[model samples]
Every structure is written in C-alpha cells, then in structure tokens.
Target: MSRFIPLSVPNLKGKELEYVTKVVETEWVSTGGGYINEFEKNIAGYLKIEKGVACQSGTAGLHLALKLSGVKYGDEVIVPTLTFIAAVNPVRYLGAEPVFMDCDDTLNMDLDKLEEFCRKECTLTNDGLINNKTGKAIRTLVIVHIFGNMANMERLIDIAEEYKLKVVEDSTEALGTYSTEGRYKGKFAGTIGDFGVYSFNGNKIITTGGGGMLVAKDKNLIDKAKYLSTQAKDDELYYIHDEVGFNYRMTNLQAALGVAQLEQLEGFIKIKMENYNLYKEEIDKIEGISILDFNKNTRANHWFYSLLIDEEKYGLSRDELLNKLNENKIQTRPIWGLIHEQKPYRNNQAHKIEKANYYIDRILNIPCSTSLAKEEAKYVCDILRELER
Candidate 1:
C-alpha cells in the first residue's frame, strides 16, 4: 500500500531545525527568551497588526479574546456552530454560553441568519447591544474563518458595531487569508475584528510544534491578552500575584520554530491553493462531487480543499465515500461535526442550522499538506476517481 495521504500536516524545511537547535544549544528551552520576542515581532510585522500575543495554543488565544470581550459568567456569545468546537468552547471557559448560528455557502457564519437570529432572539437595550431573551447580554460574537475562508466580515462587523458587541475572530484556520475588498482592505483575517486568534498546531498552514498567536488593533487589548496569558502575574521578579493567570506562554523552542515557519507561510499557502485547484480540476469531472469554492471578493488561503458530495447525484453516502477513501489509504475526512451537536455543547443555543447541516453532511477534506508532493496529489486524485466509479 502507498503511504497514506494526510488531510493536513506541517511542512518544516527551512530554519525549523536550525532555530530549534539554536534554542537547545543556548538552553533557553522552557519559555521567555529572544526567540519568543522575535516570533511575536515577526507575526506583528507579517500581519501589520498593532500587536500580537503569543500563547500556548489557539484555544488559549480564544480564551483571552473572550475575556477581553467582556464575556462574563452570565453572558451569551454569538458563535458559529459549524466550526471546530475550540472556537465555541472558550465561551464555556468564561462561564458564558454560546448562541450557535448557521453557516452560509462559504462554510462561514451565515450573515443573513446571524442578523435574523440576533433580531428575533434578542432585544436591543438602550445601549444598542442585543440582549438574549433571557436577558443575558450578547456581549460578543465569535466568527470562525473555517478552512481559511473568511466569514462575512463586512456584514458581521456591521452587526457587531450596531449591537454594541465585541468581535472575536477565530482565524485559527485562516492565518494568511485576507479580504481583497472591504472597509478593512488588505487586512489579514484575525486583524479585521476586535480580536483575532490563530493556531500553529501541527496541522495548520504553519506549525510551531504547539503554538498560536493573538492579534488586536488596540495596544491595551494586546497587553491585556499577554498579561492574561502569562497567568495575570503582577510582578515577574518578585513572583507577586494580584490575579489568576495561566502558563499559556509559548516556549522559546516553539517560537523559534514559529519564526522559521512564518517565513515559509506564503510559500506553503501557494501549495495549498495549487493543490485545491488541481483537486477541483480532477474531481469536478467525477459524478456526484462538487468542488467547494470561496467567496469571489476575498483571496482565501485555500487551506483545505473540500468536495461536497451530492449523494443524490453520486449515488453514495458521504460516510460510504469516506470509508472507501480510507480503505484505499487516501486519508480523507468530513468537515467538522457541528459544535452544537458535540457531546459537550449539545444543549447550547442553535438558530437556523439548516445550511450548516447541508455543508457538514457532504464536505470531504482531501490531502492539503504543503509538503504533499505533486505525485501524491495525483495519487489521491486517482483514488478519488476510483471511488467515484
């Protein structure tokens, strides 16, 4: 059997080893070192954001964003249910609840339903913020940029502003993606909203082994996130503590790898886009499968290539196709199961999940690793062709 094509994986060819080796040689491996500082600067410089906070994981970044958004114990946060639960779980971490919204064709937050849900399920207070029917202030909106394709940021931001809500961008899947046309022109995914979070997990466009970055337009917010991530320590040298804080700092070793990975991110993104194009070209001809597309106005990172299976036309269920691919060692998988349906969040608020269901049932993620060579792409395509037959 051929080597199994993975859905996503890290590609570290440049200075990953050299930087990690330097960290080891220098013995600053635990945390807080030159590499962490350099990695933060590199991220801020790359995205041109006001500031960035390096954290231990993307979920940690989200937790900080939620806290910065003023999400308290009794608050409600509007979140898309179609995304990875990590995007919504942070709400729970803050003792807040998530009011789940549906996704549009872009597999992003459905703007129309988002508006309607806010309108129907909420009432505007004198401050112009939407309050849930139960009167929990809908204080923030968490928008996940699923698969490196953006949510309707223009409309979502407008909604957020009108409702006096904070916007937390879960750009964990959208590191290098941006809007080509908008009020936030040329702004990167995580930078457009009130707060943005990114992941550098093993499967992301770039990997820091285990790291993520948080960005914001406000310096105070960035500082606060950094403070919160560092376990809210009052004094560093004296070990004085005024408030609770977490050890969510990304280590120097991770940051060293991040610095190298950031340098190669654009090139990695190119490979993702190219592989997506080839997948479209190869799979569009197969019956019962439709290539997923991004919104025309935006330039996506093309991080994940999705094929929506039309069971009616293709004459096979999505799981059946998934099983077939797995049996053939192609390593394809489904889009995330809706967050609302997850075991932990099964009882959360959900509004108009029709389109999200439509998407989740049919989408298949092909091998989208940057390191996946052209021959691998051909092999996966051939297996897909065989599956269609």
Candidate 2:
C-alpha cells in the first residue's frame, strides 16, 4: 500500500523535541513555567498584538472572550453557518443563542447578508442591536476566517460598529492571515476584532498537541483573560475566589511544543502556499474542477486547499471522488455541515443561508500537509484529473 497522504497534519521539523525534553527534565510540565510565558510573548509579537494569553484550547479562548464581552443568557451573537460547529458552540456555552449567517464565495461570512440582516431585520437602539424576530439583544459577532481565508473584515468591522456589536474573531484556521490593503492594512485577522482566538490543534497550521491562545488590543483584557483562565483567584495564598473561572490555562508542556511550532509557522505557511499553487496549476488543466483562490487583498495563510467540483461537468460526484481518493491511500474530506442545520442549532435563527448551503456540497478538501512534497502534490492532482476523466 502507498503511504497515506493526510488532508492536513502538523510539521514538526524544528526544536520541538529539545523544548519538550527540557520541560520534562526541569519537572515543569504543569501550567507554570518559562515556556508558557515565552510562547505567549512570541505569538503576540508575531501578530503584533498588545499581549497574548495562553489557553487550553481555542474553544476555551472563545468562551473567555464571550464571557468578557458580557454575552449574557438572553443575548445573541452573529456567526457563520458554514464554519466548524465549535465556533457556534461557544455562544451556547455562555447561555446565548447564535444567529446563523451565510457565507460568500470565499467561504467566510457574507458581509452583504450580514449587513442586510442587521439593517432590515434588526433594529439598533440606544440599548443595543435588537433582533425583531427573537426580541433579543445582539451582543457580539463571532467571525471565523474559514480555511485561513479572511472574511470581509473591513466592512464587517464597520457593520459591527454601526450596530454596536462586539467582534470576537475565531481565527483558529487563520493564524498567518493578514490584510494587505484597505483601512486596516497590514493588520492580522484576530487583532482587527475586539478579541481574537487562535488554535494549535494537531491538524492546525501549527500544533502544540492541544492548545490555543487569546489576544486583544487592550492589555487589560489580555491580563483579565489570563486571570480568569487561571481559576479567577483573587488571593492565591488564601485561595480566595472572586467570580466564576475555569481551569483553561495551557500546560507548560504544551507551551514548550507551541514555542517550537510557532518558530516554524512562517516556513510552514510558505510551504502550504507553494503546495496549494502546485495543486492549482495541475488541477486547472482538468475540466470541471478548480482550486479556490484566497482573497487577493490579504496575505492568506493558505492553510487548506479546497477543490470546487462540478458534478455535471465532472464525471464523478464529490462523494465518489472522496471515496476513490481514500481507497487509493489519500485522505480527503467534504466541508462541514451547515451549523444552523445541526441538531443543537435546529431551533436557532438563520438569516439568508443561500451560498453556505451551495458550497457545502461542492467543496472537497484535498491533501494539504506541510510536509507534502512537490511530487506528492502533483500525484494528487494527477489522480484527481484521472478521476475527472
């Protein structure tokens, strides 16, 4: 059997072992250690944000952001229906409901639909943005940069400002993505919002086994996040508690791995872009299938390469292609199901969900591991072409 080519996996070619070994040797494997601080500092520097608070997972970071943003029980948050359900689950964790929005061609949140929903369906008063249907205050907007492609942040920010909504960016898949043109030019994805969350999951562009980070423009928010993540201890000596908190701090061992992984992030992203381009070049020659392009206005991380399949033009269906590729020792996957269609979100309110449903069926994610060689990428494209024929 041929070696199985994964859809996406971590590339640990840097000092991962050295840093992890040091943590074990020093017996500092818990949350407190030098590596934790170093990892937080380095990631904040990379994004040029004020500060970063290391957390257990991206979901935890999102929960912290939602809590800090004061998303109460009766509030509603705007979220994309095409993203991973994790993005919407955090809103539920805070006893709030998610108002599902549609996706544009880029598979990010549709700014036009978002604006239309706010302008036509919602009424903005001095109290806050209120949904006419549910009669709930829309307190926040959680924007996920899907597949490392940035959403229309420039217009999204303006809409959020006009409607008085706090913006929490779910940048788990868009660590290296940044704007190259417009008013917020040169700003990273997460930093442009009120609070940004990053993931270092095993399949992410970078990995720390299972960890994440939180960042904000204000240093105070970052500090408060750190304090809240560490169990909200007001007095450590007496173990005095102020309010509710969580044990969501990233462990020292995880931070040790994160520091090393972050060191190679730029290089990994470069390889990802190159590999995506190679796939695009070969697949473009075939009829009925094409690789989607990132927003030209942004320096996208190019984390995941999605193949848009036209079943009528192409001989095989998307599912057939996915099955054939897996049978041949290549891993591929379809996009996530629409969030509003999920069981938990079935009762939730969805606004103008047209494009998201359209793309969900036609999109197939191909092999995009950073360690994928040029020949391997070509091989995947060649197989795809053959399948198309």
Candidate 3:
C-alpha cells in the first residue's frame, strides 16, 4: 500500500503556534483576547476590505449577510443550484425562498438565464419594483464563487443593481481570487458584493479549525454585522438586548489559528495555483479528460482542479472513474448536486437547470491541496491518464 492522498487539508507552517502559545500563556483561550481583534485586522488587511467580522463558521457568516441584506420572511433570493447547500440554507434560515438559477460550464450563475428570468418571469409592480410571479419580493442574490472560480461579478453586480437586489457573496472557496479586467479591475471576489462571506473550514485553503469572516464595503454595515454576530446587544452594562441576536462570534482560540493561516494565505494560494497548472498540463493531454476552466479576467485560487470527463468518448461515466480512483486511494469527488433537485428546495422555482445537470455528472474534483507535492500531483494525474486510456 502507498501513502494516502488527501483531497484537501490545512497547511499550518506559519505563526499558528506562536500566536496560540501566547494565548494559552495569557489564559485567554476563548473569545477574550487581542488575537481575536488581531485576526480580524489581519484578514481585513489581507483582503483589503473595509472590515471583516469573524464568526463561528461560514454558514453563520451567510446567515448574518442575509439578515443584513434584509432577507426576511417570504422574500426570494436568486441562487445557483450547483453549490454547497450552505450558500442557499441561509436564505431559508431567514424564512426566505431561494429561486434556483443554473450554472454555466464555469460553475457560475448563467447570467443570460438570470436576466431572462428577471425580465420574462417577473413583472414590475405599479411601485416600479420587481417581484416574483409567486408574489414574493425578490430581495437578494446569493452568488457562490464555486470552487475558487469567480462568478462574473461585474455583470452579476449590474444585474443585481438593475433588479434592485442586494448581493451577498459566498466566497468561502475564493479567498485569494481577484479580477484584473472590466469594471472589476483589481477587485477581489467578495469585496465587490454587498456582503462577502468566507469560510475557514478544515478542508478549505486556510483553516481555523472551523471559522468564517464577513466583509463589506460599507463600514456601518460591517459594524452592524459584528453587532449582529455578537448577539444584537445595545451598549451593555447588564447585557441589555435591543433585537434578537446570535452568539456567532469567533473564539480567541480560533482567531489565533486564523492569524497564523492569514500569514500563510499567499504562499498557500501560490502552491494551489502551481498544482492546478500541473494538473492541467499533465491531465489535459489525455484523450477524454478536460481540465476545468478558470476566468482569465480574474485569477482563481484554484481551490479544486476539476476534470470533466467525456463519458461518451471514454465509454465510461464519471462515477465509474470515481469508483476506480477511490479503489486506488486517489481521492476524487463529484460536483455538488443541484440544490433545486433536493427535497427541501423542490417547491422553489428553477430556471433552465439543464447546464447545471450537464456539468454535474462530468465534473470530478481532483486533489489540489497546498500540502500536495509536485510528484504527488503528477502521480494522481498519471492514475487518471491510465484510467482514461
């Protein structure tokens, strides 16, 4: 047997120990410490956003972002069906409905259909406000930058602006991706949205055991987000509460880990991109395997290097290859099941989900972790190449 190859894992070679050790010595292991604030500052600095509120997890961040976006009972938020359910669950958390949108080959919202739905299926009321045909106010759009490849943010932003929709970005997979062209020139993925949320789950590019950050362009919105995360309390001498709040704040221990992860984010992104390139170069040459595409206008962190299998050409399906890869201890995964197809979201309106279904069976995410060496990446692709032929 050979060493097992992990799909993705944390890379902690930076200040994690030093910061955590200091917190332990100071006896401030929970939420009370400088590291929490320092970690917030570190991430804000790295992302160059107005502010970042660290929370219990990315799901919590999405919850806060939706709440802040004024997603209330019976509202509709347009969301991609091909995403981790966390991206859409927050909409449900607010008692809001998610109008499912389809994904293009880029694994992003299909703008053409998104626009078509807004124009044809929806009508502007006498108030000149667009509302869903179901008579619900379509209030927000939750755009996930899936697998570190950015959605077309500029066009998406334009559509949001036109529809009077608040945009909340699920940027959990796109920590270091940025655009170099169009209206999004020099813009990072999450920063362009009304509320940008990130995850530091254990398998993410960076990890704080489990944590999340919420960022926004407005300083007041960011402050309000922090307030909401801290339990919506007014100035408190005796824990006076104004509105319902959540204990969603990140702990000092998690922030200590975050500080360390922040210090090494750039290096981790470099390794991830290099590994993606290596996968593309080595695997794309095979007859029936195609490397996933990245948006050149923006550089993706290349979180997951996906291979789209030509099932017809190879006389095999993606699941067949997936099973074989698993048998060989080469971990690979299928893309997320479309959310609209799920039991919970079945009643929600879906627009043109054909493209999402197209890529769903074909896309297989390969290991492209920062911890993976060049040789290990080559070996994984070699397995795929052998399986292909």
Candidate 4:
C-alpha cells in the first residue's frame, strides 16, 4: 500500500533483457536486423494473418494504412470520438478530414450510428461514399478496438462494404483480442479488416519500448508497407527512390524486446483476465461504482479496466474520486475527453455523441497493470469500499 499502484505498466519479467543483450552483442541495433523480421513474422503468425510490417509506432502504422487505403487530400475518414486521439490524428496526417462517430456502451464506435450515418447522411457513388455536407469521398473507416474490446466488426464490415469504405482496424489496444464466434471467429482484432495496427508502447500488454506492427489482408500491400516504412528504396544498393517514404522502421533493439515480450503475451493476457474478474466481482458490489465489461463474443486482452462512477450514489464526482485516489497514492485516471471537443477538433463533425458524452464524465481508469499484485488490487478495492462510507 505504501508504493503507488500505477494504472498500467509493462510486465518485463520475461526474457527482455536476454534478447536485448543478444541484439546489443550482435551490433545490429538499428532498423535492419534479424530481430525485426523475426518479430514481424512472430506477430503475423500469432494473429494468423498473412503478413505484418513493423514500424515506429501505432500512429505511424495508421498513417501508412490510410495512405495505402487510398485516402488523399480533401477526403474524409470515419472515426470514433471516444478513442485516443492517435486513432483520429492519422486521418489528418494524410490531409484528410475526420467524421467522428459516437461510442456504444463498450466505448467502441457505435455501429448503429455508423450504419445510419452511411445510409442516411452519405451517398455512394462510383468514386466511393461521398458525404452530403462536404461532397468529399469517405475513403476509409478507422475502427479502434477501444481498450482491447472488439467492436462489432461483423456488422461494421457489412456497412463498410455497402458504402465502399476501406476499413482500417486500429487494434493498438487489442493486440491479443479476437472474436470467439460468428464470421470472424478465431480472427484476431487486427486481422479482420483491410488493415490492422498494433502498438508496443510502454504501457501496453506487451512492450517493445516504442514500436508497432501493421497487417493487411493482401500480401502485396504488406510488401509495399515495408518498403514505404524503410524509405521506399527502389534499389537498395543505389538508394534509388521511386516515391515518398518514411523513416518509420522499427529498430532491431525494439524488435528484440518485442520478440521476448511476445513470447509472454498469452501469459500476460491470462493474468489480466483473472485480475479483471477479481476487480469486477468486488467493485460491482460497491454502491455506485462498477467495472466495465468487454463484449461477450470476444476474448479481449483486458488491457485496461474502466470504473463507472455515479456521482449522486458514490457521493463524489469523477474528478473528486480521481483526486482522492491520488491523495491515497492509488493512481487513477479519467477517460479521455471526447476527441470532438478537443481544441483542435472542435469544428470537426461529430454525429449523435450522446452516450460518449455520458460515459466520459463517469468513467475512471484504475490500476490494472499486469505486474499488479493481487494484494495490491485488494488494497485498491478496500479504499474504494471505505470511500463509499
């Protein structure tokens, strides 16, 4: 109880050091090395996907995905206002606009709203789905599997097909999440869409310090992504460039960490699932706070846990509880401010954001780190229980 319980932290007890030491000894610490290729292949194999391209970060992967999806200047991309800003910023990176959609109870894009927006507010043309208001093509749909919970992809995919929108699954927070039934049964979060991206940030279920992976249904596109990531070398020996490229390749050092971290990914997910159940069982019994649940049809990675608080019942506002938790040395954070309301995005179109607004004010993220001890979780619950009185 004396030590601060972080909201999320990397579980590096695996062979991270040994693998990184090997990379250091080999002197191939930059982008080109065996670790990079091994990490990409391992991730693609884990997801049961055809190929994966390693890159610098999830944001970079998204930018590349959008570019590969044919998003261009003056185009628009459908996105979720309830997700982290990284998911939306990539659209702007391509000089495209974003149409922010609301979130369902799962804190994922509301497929109902997305379908309605496409059917009622846009027109499908030979070019693609065109926004009635802007008259620009809606080229892509970026779906973020928020907090490792799979969005209703079965329904979303149909909507995209009908509207002619290319789908990009922003699976940054859902590395191991997958559907257990229906069409996408056994398909991992990042594998079901036209393109999918994974992050290896310090706080994710697995960590490569700072790196990401991109997967696509088409093998050729995967090859293109790799070329674009590594400076678009037309002829590597001559450094001939046929087009614009980015210095976004993942370093061998990071990939070494990723290879080791991935080996323990399933184990990390197991611990996360168990801890989530423990938190839910105890927290649900409290007067005004309860743990958020993932979709029933998917096996989520349980990356982060959400605590919904009712101010009238809990006798404290969400901010009040956040401050109290900080005072008690129990680290907690509020859900992200709706992206639509942020200063830079205030003018962007956000459709029917009722539930997202409601959830934003009530949701708090508590300590759910993979390294978190059971006793530490118990201590957190005890504090919340005591606060109820």
Candidate 5:
C-alpha cells in the first residue's frame, strides 16, 4: 500500500468541471445563479420534498431551523451525545440549552430513555413541554442519523408528537437514506421530520466544496429559511431588511458542483454500499471485531463503516489498531467523544449516557470514501488481519 487510503473524500469524477465552467463562463459564480436553483430543485426532488434551501454549511441550515422551530431564549432541545457537536450547537446559537440524550445500539438517540425523560422527568404545560429539572420549555428534538444510518424515526416521531416537540432531522450523514417498512415508508431521512438538513462538505457522501441544504414538510418554512439564508431581504428592489438574518447563502460555484454531484449521487451510493458489503465479508472472517450494520428497515447511503473492537478478543486495543493502520498508510479514526463530555458542554444536562461512552472508545471509522477502490479496501482488511495475528 504505497498510497495512503483516506478515511473519506469527495468523488468528483462527473460533470463537476463542466458545471463549474458554465458558472464561470456565465459569470454567475456568486450567490445568484441558475445552478443554485436547479441544485435545490434536484435535491428536493430526490428526497421527495416540496423544496430545498441551500446554505453556506449544514451548521448554518441547522441554526436557521432551530430559529424557525421556535426555540427561544432559555428553551431546551433534546440532543444525542454520541453525535458530532454541530448537531447540538445550533441550540446554543438560538440562546437555548441542550439536554443531551444517550445512544442506543444504532448510535442514535435512545428513544426509550427519551420517552422515560418525558414521562418521568418533565411535564407538559400550556406553554409547551416543560423540563422539570431546568424549568425551561422543551421545544425541539434534534435527531441525527449516525453514519448514514436512519434512526428509529417511527418511534422517535411518536414520542415527539406525544410530547409536542418539534423535530429537526440532522440528516447530514444520511442524505440518501429512506424508510422501507413503516408508516413513513418511502420518506427520506430529511423529509420525515419537520425540518431536515444535508451537508455537502468535502468528506460527505457528496460535496459542493462546502455547503448544505434545508428541507421541510411545509413550503413556507423552506421559503423562509431560504430568505433568512440570504439576509432576509423583505424588499429586494429597495434592499429593505425585515429581520436579523445570516449571510449563509451557498455560492453559485458550490451549487454548480452540487448539481453535478447530485447527478452521480445514486451511482456513488451504489459503490459505497458494495464496498461496505465487501468490507463486512472480509472483516467478518476476523475475530474480535465486526462491522456494524445499518437499520435493516431503511436503505442507508453507507457514508461510513464503523468497526466495533473488543480489545480482549481482538488482541489489539482500538488505539493500537488505529495507530498501526495509519502507520501502514491506512487511515482510521475514532468515533467522536461524547458531546456532553466536551469542556464546553460538560456542565449541561446529560441524561444516562451509558452506551455512548462505551462505544466511543471502541468504535473506529475506517476508509469509506465513495471512490475507494476494491484493492485498497482489501489492503485495509489485510492490515487489520495482520494486526489481529
């Protein structure tokens, strides 16, 4: 393995150059361009949503969604501790706090504990669901589909409705995931919630250099999110501003790349799924480690493949294997540290985060780029087997 296998990287072997060239030729490379609108439409159409609004990044889209979800100052949002911090930071951006929730076997928000928290720890009032611990309104829940795997949306949504909590689906890692057997069958990850957001970062399933899209069940919310992303211009002709807004508009260049990337998205997903299955087969031959599968009820995009390592059985610790693989020119990364354990969020309320802590130290993300070659994957597995020996 002379070449280093990257954990993840964008696959841009399509009309990306052509589309970006068109944007440059038409001099529409800024925020305004035909490609931006088309990209939004293509994304919305793919997800079977009414509309999609492009923003500078997923974090910005989440911030706008949190604002629209009516998470006012002092409001509380139930978030997952096992996910990237971006999923919970938007709550702070809106002057609200986040009550961190634990992860289940799927590495998603534990719906059982979530229900328990609502039933035993909180009370529903006229204002909203009030958290008895903080005496603040529980206004929303941010559900992140970890590693392109769809969470148990069927149960999560029921709990949300029963508790009157607005749902925001952080589908940043799950753009192509959709339910197959449920009431929301055929509903995409982002479309099932009140608001869903997708990331087009360089390392995501797709890339637009760096950008995101926001979709919602209601047209007005999507429209307003679009407006707020572009500085909330009430009257464009006179440049009149109506409210505090963010300059979070995605560039025409990025959207140009996005449209081209979206065209190849399904094909990319196919390759990713195939590679994931291949890895699963090879890794299963080894002892003390296993590749975790996605929820069988949904079709996942397979953005990342997580390896569960049992140190005693594997003969090597997770950190030891990580270092060995990287030294052998294979890139691997540990799962994110629990959000509640981070310094900035340590003092925030965290509810029974047991499984998250357990998996955080054992889960390792191996190379899973859409463009990863079969030989490279085999090379990666060969190294793992060597470590086991």
Candidate 6:
C-alpha cells in the first residue's frame, strides 16, 4: 500500500530487451537501420494499413500528417478540446488555426456539433469549406481517438466527404482499437481516415521510449511522409534537399523497442481490458462514481479508464478525491483542461464547448496500467470507497 501506484505506464515484459540488444550489438543505434523498417511494417500490418512512416514522436507524426493533408497557412482545422494539447498543436505548426469542438459523453469529438458547425458556421466554396467569421478555408479535420475509444467515424467521414475536408485520425491512444460493425467493419481506428497517427510515448498503450508512426490511405502519401521525416532527401548520395523537411525520423533504438512492444500488443490489450472490466465492476457499485464505457461497436484497447465523479453524489469534488488518492499513494489524475480555455488557444474558435467543460471537472483517470495487479486495483477501489462520504 505504501508503493505509489501510477495511472498509466509502459509494459515492456516482452522481447524489448532482446530486440534492442540486437540493435546495439549491430551498432545500428541511429535512425537508419532494420529496426525502423520492421517497426513500421509491423505497425502497418497490425492496423491493416497500406504503409506507415516512423517518426520521432506522435507530435512529429501529426505535424507530418497535417502537412501531407495540404493544410496551409490561413487555413482552419477542426479539433477536440477534450484531448491532450499535442493533438491541437500540430494545426498551429502548419500555420493553420484550430477550431476547437466539444466532446460527447464518450469524450470524443461531438459529431453532432461538428456537423452543425460545418453547416451553420461555414459556407461551402469551390475551393473547400470556408469559415464565415474569418473567411479562412477549413481544410482538414483532426480527430483524436481519445483514450482508445473510436470516434463515430462512420458519421464523421460522411461529414468530411460532404464538406471536402481531409480527415486526420489521431489514433495515438488507439493502436489496437477497431470497428466491429458498419461500412468500416474490421477497420482500425487509424486506417479509415485520410491520415492516421500513433504514439509510442512512455505512458501510452505501447512504448518506444519516444516515437510515433504516420499512416495514410494512400501509399504515396506514406512515401512522401517518410521522405519529409528524414529531411526531404531527394538524393541521399548527394545529400540533396529539394523541399523543406524535418529531422523527425525515429531512432533505431526506439524502433527496436517499438517492434518488440508491438509484438505483445494484443496481449497487453487483453490485460488492459481485464483490468478495466475489474475496475468497472467494482466502481459501478460505488455511488456517485462509475467507470466510463467505450463504444459498443468497437474492440477498444481500453488504454485509459475514466472515473466519472459526481461531486454532489460522491460527497467530494474531483480534486478532493484526487488529493486523497494521492495521499494514499494512489496516482489518479484529472483529465486535461479544455484546450480552448488554455492561454495559447484562448482566442481560437470553440463552438458549443458544453460537455467538455462538464467532463473536464468530473473525470479522473485511475490506475489502469497493463502491469497493475488485481490486488492493486482492489486497493484503489477500497480507497475510493473509504473516501466516499
């Protein structure tokens, strides 16, 4: 009970050490190596996508995806305010602005509000969807699959096609998630969009220490992204650079870790699902707090479990509960603050940000790591129950 239980952490009990040791033994420690290629292929094959481009981090992958989507200066991209700020920062990196959208009960972008914003707040032009307020072209939609829950892609894709918007799926937290029904049946969260991005951060569902992968429906786009990620080398022999590029390529060490981690992804997801169900069963019986459920039509990775606390019913505010848990050595965390309210994005457009604000204050992420023991989960629940008035 004295040990600090973390909210989320990497599970590396696979071939990570063996693969990375091979990389080190071969002296292929930098970006150029077999590990990177294998990691890319493994991720692409896992998601059943055409191709993937490995990059330094999820932020880098997002930047590359936005650039490949033809998002330009003076353009606008739709994003969710309920997600990590990294998802929204890429829009600005491309010299475009982000139009923050609200979240639904599932904490994904509100499809209804997105449709409403596109229909009532913008005008369809020969070029594309144009914002009436700023007269800027609304070029792309960045959809973050928050906490591995698949967004309503079936409806979102319809909205994108009707409005001529390129869709970028931020599948950073949804590597193992897939749709089990509808037109995109069996499609992974990242594959159905114009571009899909995944993260391998230290605390993600998988870890490469730090890296990311960019995938797209078009193989040519993947090729271009790989080119850009490695400094746009038109001719590597001459070190010729025809276009501006970035040093976003992932290291051989990271890719080695990623390749091994990806091999155990299905198993890790199994553990995550089991732990999530265990928490749900126990927390459901506790008044004023319950575990949020993923979409029924999809097999989610169950990356992170959200604990919804009703202040009045729970007898404590989210922060109060968070503090008590931390004091008891349980590492619980509140959801990210609404991005629209952040200082840097304060002036950006946020349409009907109602539900996001409501959830932001009530939702706390509890310990759900793949390494979390069953007794540890029970201990967390017992602490919550004890703290409940």
Q: Best candidate per lDDT, number?
A: 6
Task: Report the error of model 6 at residue 59, Å.
Answer: 0.6
Candidate 2: what lDDT? 0.92
Q: Would you estimate the TM-scores of all the predictions?
A: 0.97, 0.99, 0.97, 0.99, 0.99, 0.99
Runs in model 4 deviating more than 4 A are: none
Per-residue lDDT of candidate 2, residues 1-389 (tens digit): 37888888888889999999999999999989999999998998899876899999999999999988879998999999999988989899988999999999999988999999999999999999999998999989999999999988889989999999999999999999999999989999899989999999999999999989999877898899999999999999999998888999999999999999998989998999899888888888999999999999999999999999999998888899999999888999999999899999999999979998889889999989899988888889778877875
User: Model 5 — TM-score against the truth?
Assistant: 0.99
Clashes of each: 2, 0, 0, 0, 0, 0
lDDT of 4 at 50: 67
Give the Å error, residue 252, model 4. Answer: 0.3
Query: What's the lDDT for all of these models?
Result: 0.86, 0.92, 0.87, 0.93, 0.93, 0.94
Clashing pairs in 6: none
RMSD of each: 1.4, 0.9, 1.3, 0.8, 0.8, 0.8
- For model 5 the local lDDT of residue 52 reads 92
lDDT of 5 by residue, 1-389 (tens): 79989999889899999999999999988999899999999998898777899999999989998899889998899999999989989899888999999999999889999999999999998877999988999989999999999999889989999999999999999999999997988989989889999999999999999999998888998888988998889999999997988999999999999999999999999999999999999999999999999999999999999999999999988899999998999989999988999998989999988999899989999999988999999999898888895
Candidate 6, 247: how far from true, in Å? Answer: 0.2
Those runs of model 6 whose alpha carbons end farther than 4 Å from true positions after fitting are none
Residues 313-358 of candidate 3: C-alpha lDDT, one tens digit per residue: 8656999998988888888889888899999999988987888989
Query: Which stretches of model 2 miss by more than 4 angstroms?
Result: none
lDDT tens digits by residue: candidate 6, 120-196: 99999999999999999998999999999999999999999999999999999999999999999999999999999
lDDT of 4 by residue, 1-389 (tens): 78989999888898999999998999999988999999998998899876799999999999999999999998999999998999999888889999999999999999999999998999989988999988988989999998999999999899989999899999999999999999889999989889999999999999999999999998899999999999999999999999999999999999999999999999999999999999998998899999999999999999999999999998889999999999989999999989999998999888998999999999999998989899999999999998985
Q: Which clashing pairs does model 3 show?
A: none
Candidate 5 clashing pairs? none
